[model samples]
Each structure stands twice: as structure tokens, then as C-alpha cells.
Target chain A: MDERAALDLVGGLVGRAGDDAAVVDGTVVTTDMLHESTDFPAGTTRYTAGWRAVGASLSDVAAMGAEATAAVAVYGAPAFDAADLEAFLSGARDVCERVDAEYVGGDLDGHDEFTVASTALGETDDPVTRAGATADDVVCVTGGLGRSAAALRAFDAGDVDRANDLFQFTPRVAAGRALAPYATAMMDSSDGLARSLHQLAAASDCTIDVDEAAVPAVDAVADYATDDADAREMTVFFGEDFELVCTLPDDEIATARDACPVELTVVGDVTGDTAAASSDGAVTVGGDALPDRGFTHGD
Target chain B: MDERAALDLVGGLVGRAGDDAAVVDGTVVTTDMLHESTDFPAGTTRYTAGWRAVGASLSDVAAMGAEATAAVAVYGAPAFDAADLEAFLSGARDVCERVDAEYVGGDLDGHDEFTVASTALGETDDPVTRAGATADDVVCVTGGLGRSAAALRAFDAGDVDRANDLFQFTPRVAAGRALAPYATAMMDSSDGLARSLHQLAAASDCTIDVDEAAVPAVDAVADYATDDADAREMTVFFGEDFELVCTLPDDEIATARDACPVELTVVGDVTGDTAAASSDGAVTVGGDALPDRGFTHGD
Candidate 1:
């Protein structure tokens, strides 16, 4: 079974599985598991790995428009190293502090490979969901895309410093909290812009018409890509930017932009027309279908 | 670094460690990581693995004297099998149902080895910690010991059915909730009675005198052991029974016994005398020092 099908099976048993985080009585909780082979690159430092791993779960909380309170990590490796463990904890603590949250310890065990499972806890009385988008709502994204793609390129080129720096993107918790009151629907763009757009449209039963020119591509994309088309492709499909992709009323866009701490780029608008909708939900950019592909586990 | 030393380092960074569960306001949260090589035997089924792994986290919540609300797990393995995934989810759901908690959902990833990370969330107005044991308090335990030891013995002896059955021991959530009002200091004996006794004594700054004859050993211990001495050794030193070990006021022991659903066995008492206390904290059984040995990770 693939990750999605396995997730569906888990959903069948648990009944509450599709949301980014599970909320119970105003408390939001989410968990993310990452393996060294799949998540970290060849030159990735233990500190970078720790930051990226915990940041993934915190991004889930951000998707729910929740106030991140604390996080705990479970680290498993074949053996324990004193300096490496300290570096990992230092990174985890720094990331939590960056988001105004606490890193409140975790469990450790020995395994064959370096693996991390991080859980983040948050709070929100009015949490956002992917299924709340409506026709005529404006879709927007935070910061720039293709940051992780640029990082991977740098790693492949043996520029470890540039790769590590790019790997340390800030999670959009503050922006999510600021936009929560104005967003009609919201989710994090961890799955890349294309896949995230498809998911939001499908969940809301709408079509998203995105202007390819309006998507914000990071400056690094130009340095890494061969052409403008390649840059757009990389920005739109390569994930791990840790940016928020959300929908808001056209009238509330200016207010949300004012309230948000990060740059808000207007990328698209939602529509109720089924003419453009497909099984994977309609996500059209520059009058063409956007492929439903992004960062997925066990691919 | 060993697991304990690593945990202390984490505690130094987080400033809120050493407790079974971290309490924030009225919310209780805990996490556990287990590896196949360290946690599961050759004949252990995926279903039993799921139950035991999630039960470990729930047992932590129970030790905090909290009401378990929900749990999430991150499952990572070398490959995904449909039947195995379904069985694992079924076991997770069944265990949550047994404790009246929700098995909400989890994340999945492919790793080189089968590993599981589980987190349990709970609610409590007053959580019992391991630092409240006072002199003259009676030390009591719930359920029988050596259950996991006997299960391991059965697994080694080719009794897979008996081993699986024994691995499905219930988490002591209800009994902990019942004993919360009376328990001055409480914890789950996941590290065996010896280590747990030593830990509680150190945390509370006291000494514990245990009656070796009063320790309750399960019937399976005798069935698997060669003689009474071996049975007693297994029961006292082999851990993973998921039973509650608590210190209660001498005057409240009778009422606590009446309130708890499980049979309460009074096997020891707390004392203020430093003559018997050592660096690992004093735990004397029949006038002899109890060795601080139990199940530990990466041992």
C-alpha cells in the first residue's frame, strides 16, 4: 500500500484522520515521522535534521491556525553519540523558541537507522480546516516557494553551508494565527503548491484557477533552474517551504495581509464550476492542469 | 551516553523532564519510542506490537493520574503490508476502546527497521508526581508482576499464543484515576519494581523497605521459572507489567484499596532514615539492598 492508501485505511479505523491536526476541546495535536534516508540529505547536519523534523509537526499546527504551545521528539538511532545528541536537542530547542513554543523533552531509543518522530501540541478555539473554502474565495500563499528545491540543489552541488541555511526555513505559526480569523480555509504548503492546491480544492469541492505569474518564486530558484519555465515548475512542485496556503474572502485579503507577519502573495481564486474539476480536484495554472505530485512518503 | 544520561541532558535543555508526563494547565502529554529489535521478539505479531507500543504511552499517562483522552502513533517500517497495517490499526483501536480513549490517527513512513513512536494526551486537574512520597507512607502496587518476563519466556519456549496473550495487558488508567486522590507519589513500574522503587525514593528523598514475601507474582511466573527463587527474581526485577506502583498515606490505604478497581498489594513503607539510603536511593527488601536493575533501552 502507498502512503495515501495506508492513511485511508488508518482513517477507516480511527474515523478522524485527514485533518492536519486532531483537535480535542480546543487542544490541537499532530505527529510526524521522518527517516534519515528519506528526509535528510547526504550532507545534512544532525542539527538541521532535528530542526526540520520538529518543524514538520509544528507546520501541521500552523495549518490548523493553532497557537503552538510545546513539542516533544522521539529520536531513534543505531547508537547514541553525546555531541550529536546535544546538537539535535539544541536545534529542536532553537526551533521551538523561534515559534514562541517550548521543547519539553522526549524519549530516546536505539534503532538501525536515525529516525525521528515529533509531536507538537497547540491550542485554538477557532481552528481552520481544509474543507471550509467557498466559491469566490481568494487563495494566497506565504513567503516564497522552491526554497527546499534550492536547498536540495545546493546539497547535490556540495554546498553544505548553503544547503543547511536553506533547510532552516521558519514555520508560519505566527502568520497562521494572524490569518485564522480571516481565512475561509487554510493549510500548510508542505506538500508543495500543486498538491496543496489540489487537496484544498478537493476538500472544499471547488476549482482553483491559479495565475502562474503570481506564484512567488524564491531568488534561489533562478540560480538553480535552467530557465523561467523550469524555475516555475520547481517553485510550484518542490515542497518543504513550510509556508501557509490559505483561502480568504476577496474583501478580507487586504486585512489579512495587514495582520500577517509574512508576505502574502495572491495566487488564485476558488470557483464552483465542475467544468474544470477532475477526480483529483481542479487546479489549473496558466490554462493547464497542474499535476498532483509533491513530497510523499514511501514513494 | 546511556538512556538515563541522555534523558538528563534533555531535561537540562527543556527544564521540564524526569516526570512521566508533562502537565500543561490541565492537559497531560507523553511520548514513547520502541524499536523492533529491542522491543519485540521473533514471534511477536504486528498487532501485538501496536498494542504494546501504544500501551506504553498510555501507561505513562496513567502514572500521572490523568484521564486518557486520545493517542497518536507514528509507524515506520522497511515495507508496508496491507494485512499488517490493518492488524496494527485494529490493535491500536481496540486498546483505545478498552480504556475509553480515542485512537485518533497517526503518520506513516518507510524506514530500515520496524519502529513505532506513540504519544498519549490526557486531562487532569491534579496530576500525581513521583516527588510526594513522605515518611510513614505505605508503598502499594496494583496487578501482578513478571507478566512481561513470563511472556518473553513463553516466546522463547515456542508458546506464541501464550506470549501474545500476555503482551496484551491493560494500561492502569482507571486504577490510577481511582487512586489519584490518595496516591502521594505514583508511577508505572515499566522499569521493574527494583528500579521504580529506587527512582521513587530518590525523587521523594526517602527510603523504602519492601517485604519480599508480599510481592505478588503472576501464576505464569511459577509456570515458567525453575523454582521459587527464580520466580521471585523475575517478578521483582523483570519489568513491562504496566502496573501502578504508588505511595499512599498509611491512614488512606484502606480507602484507596476500596476505591481502586485492581487489587492493591501493600508491600513496603517509606522511611526518613538516611542510614539505608544510597546514591541510587535506598530500596531495601527483607533487610537487603535491592539492585537497581531492570529493562532499559540499548542495554
Candidate 2:
């Protein structure tokens, strides 16, 4: 089974398992495991791998609208190279520091392939979940989409430095906390806009109708994609940008924008279209059906 | 570098890195990553693997004198068999239930080898650290030692049922919380009693003198080992028992005993003699030197 089906099985076993981060007693906790072959591309530095792996969990904390506190990683590889190990730690620490979180120590092990399992923790009295959205809520996202898609293009072109830079997008922790008070529902767009919108719709029991013209496409997409249509497809279907996708009432958008450090772009609106709702939820972009296609681990 | 040296490197990078579980705002969190080749022996079932992997993180929580609230694991394997996956989740959930903690959902991915990364979160107002032992405090252990060593022997003898049963040791969460208020220092002996004593001594800046005869070797050790000395060696040096080793004052032993559910076996005492202190904290057993030997991950 794919990641989504596996998650469904997990949800069946765990009572509180649907949220991006599991919040227990005001503490938000999440974990992400990345394998070298599956996650890191050719020429990707150990440092970049470390940063991206840990940042994935941090994004979950951000999705919960919690104050990022600390993170730990478990690194495994066939052999320990001093420089690579040091670089990995530096990357992990730097990313945590960027988001006002501490990079606590982690475990190390020997494995045939390089692997990283990162866990991030945060705190919040009020956590915004994907299940809280209403029909009238405006759908919005922080930063833009397709940054990771562009990074993949760069990696394909052997632009290692550019790819690494693209992989270093900041997790929207501050923006998440700022929008928590006003956001009806929130989650991270690590699985692409289309998939995330579908998830948000299903969780909130509503449909999300996207205005294609209003979707914020990162400039990097133009530099990497073959054409404008390709860029739009990349922005909607490719994931790993680590951006926050949230919903808010139309009246609260101005206040949320004022409080948020990053730009909040409105891309869609939650709708009361129960007739169109299916297992994948009714998600449309540019008046066209959006498929549930994105990064699926273990696929 | 080995696991200990790697830990030192990690300790140097993160200030609050030496504890078993990092305590932040009264919340304790710890993570453990285990690989199939390194951690699981032949004849091991996926269920046992899940139990032992998650149990390792719970042991860390128990060591910190906290109430475990929840746990999440990230599992990666070459392929996902329906039965294997279900069994793994069941094992993980059962272990959490045993400790009164929730088995929260986890992430899954495809990897070249089977791997599990588990994180456990706990809560506590007062956390017991490994650095609190004093000269006059008595060193004690909960549960017995050499259980895992015996399990390994069982596995070698093709006693899969007995091995799996032996591998399923209960994490001393309740006993740890009970001892927290009175114990001066506390840690789990996953790394075996000899190494644990050395670590406790070094962290507490004291020496530990052990009565070897008093060491509670599991009765199964006799069935596994060739002789009494072999059993004693296994009890002291072989690890993965998941028992708590603590330090308590002589006068408070009775109160601690009453509060604890498990047997509080007094095997040693902290000493003031600093002249003999080495890097391993001058640990001795039965008037002889006890080497810092135990299971070392990534060794």
C-alpha cells in the first residue's frame, strides 16, 4: 500500500493520528524518516540532506501552529566520515536555529545506506488542525510552490549549488503561529498543493475551489520548467516546498496578513459542495478537476 | 568513532545533549533508530522488532523519571507485507499500552533495509538525571540483568518463541516515576550494568563499588551460559535489559521500595574516593575493576 493507505491504517489504530503533528498536553511532536536513495539526489551534500530531513518534521510543527521548541535526529550510514558527520550536524543545527528551535543531540548508527530520522517538538495552547475549516473559509498558502520541483530540475542539470540553495526553504513556523488565532484550519504543503487541498477538504468535510490565476508560483519554476503550463503543473503537483497551507474567514485575512511575517496568498476557497465530494474530496483548480498526485513515500 | 565518541561529539554541539531524554518545559522526549542487520537477529519477527524498537525510546523516558504520554515511530522497509505491517503496529501499540502510553501513528517509507525510528514523549515536574548521585547514596537496579543475553542464546539455539518472549521486557516507567522523588540519580541499563555503573559514576562525579554477588542476574542466564562466571559476565556486560539503575540514600531505601512496584536490588554504593577516579569513574565489582563494556551501537 502507499503512504496514504498506510496512514489510513495508522489512523484506525491511533485515536489522535490525523493531524500533521500529534499534540499531547500542549506539546506538538512529529517525526520524518528519509532514505538516501529515496530522498537525496545525486551530488546532494550531507548537509543539505540533514537540513531537509529535520526541516520536514519542523514543517509539521509549523502546521500545528505551535512555537517550535527543539529537534533531534538519528543519522545512520555505512561508515562515519568526520567531515560529513560534522557537516550534517551543522546543517541540522542551522535549520533549527533559523526557526528559533534548539537542535538537541541525536543518535547515530551504522547502516548500508545513509538515513536520517528527525523528530521535532513544539508547544501551543491553541493548535489549528486541518479538520476545523468551514465552507466560507478562504484557502491560503505561505511562500510559493514548486521550489523543490525547481530544485529537482537544477539537480538534473548538475547545478548542485543551486539545488542545495533551493532545498533550504525556511519552514513557516513564525507565520503558522501568527495565523493560528485566525486560521480555521492549517497544514503544510509538503505533499504539493493539489494533494494538500484535497486533504484539507476531506478533513474539513468541504470542497476547495482554486483560482488558478491567483495561485502563487515561485519564480524558480520559470527557470526550470519547459513552459508556463509546465510551471503551473509543477506548482500544483510537485511538493517538498515546506510551505504552510491554511484557511481563514475572509474578514480575518487582513489581520492574518498584518501579523504574518511571510506573504499569505489566497489561492482558493472552501465550498459547500457535498454532491461533488468523494473519497479524495472535490478539489478543483482553474475550474478543472485536480488529481491527488504528489510525493508519496514508499510508493 | 564509536557510539560513545560520537555521542561526545554530539554533546559538544548541543548544550543539553547528555541526558537520556531531553527535558524541555517539563516535557521529556527521546528518539531511537534501529536497523534490521544491526539490531534484529535471525528468527526475529516484525512484531518483536516493533516492540523492541519502540520500547527502547520508552526506556529512555523511564530513565528520565517521567510519565510517558505518547510515542510515534517511522518505519522503513524494502517492502510492506500486509501481515507484517499489521503485526508490527500491533506490537508497537501493545507495548505502549503496557506502559500506559498512547501509541500514536507514525510515518512509513521504502528503504533498502528494514529500519525503525521511534520517538517517545513524556511529562514530569521533577526529572531524575544521571548526574545526581552522591558519595553516600546506594546504587540499585530494578528488574534483573542478562535477559537479552539469554534471548540471544535462545535465538542461536533456534528457540524463536522463547527468544521473542525474552526480548519483550517491560519498560520500568512506573518504577522510575516512583523512584524519581527519592532517587538521586537514575538511568536505564540498556547498555548493561557494568557500563551503566560507569556512566552513572562519571555523570555523578563519584565512584561506584559493587557487590557482584548482589547483582540480580536473570535465572534464564544459567540456562543460556556455560558456567556461573559466564552467566555473571553476561549479567554485567551484555545489555538490552531495559531495567532502571538508580541511586538512593540508605535511609530512604525503605520508602523508595514501598513506592516502587519492581524489586529494588541494592548491588552497589557510591563512594567518595576520588583518587582512583578514571574516565570510567573508577567502577569496581567484588573488589575488582569492572570494564566499561556493553552493547555499543554503530561499533
The regions of model 1 sitting more than 4 angstroms off are A273-281, B273-281
Candidate 2 residue-wise lDDT, B136-232, digit = tens: 8999999889999999999999999999998888889999999999999999998889988888887888888999989998778989899988998
Which has the greatest DockQ? 1
Worst lDDT run of 10 residues, candidate 1 chain A, spans A272-281
User: Across residues A1-299, which tens digit of lDDT does each residue of candidate 1 receive?
Assistant: 88777877787777778888888879899998887787898998889988988898999999999999999898887777888898898888889989998888788887778888999999999999998888899999999999999999999999999999889888899999999999988999988999898888877878998988899987888889988878877798878778999999999999999999999999998866555575544888755788889877877
RMSD of 1: 1.8
Per-residue accuracy of model 1 over B39-84 as CA lDDT, tens digit each: 8898989899889988999999999999999999988877788899
lDDT of 1 at B182: 96
Residue A254, candidate 2: C-alpha displacement in angstroms: 2.1
Clash pairs, model 2 backbone = none
What local lDDT score does residue B143 receive in model 2, on the 0 to 100 scale? 82
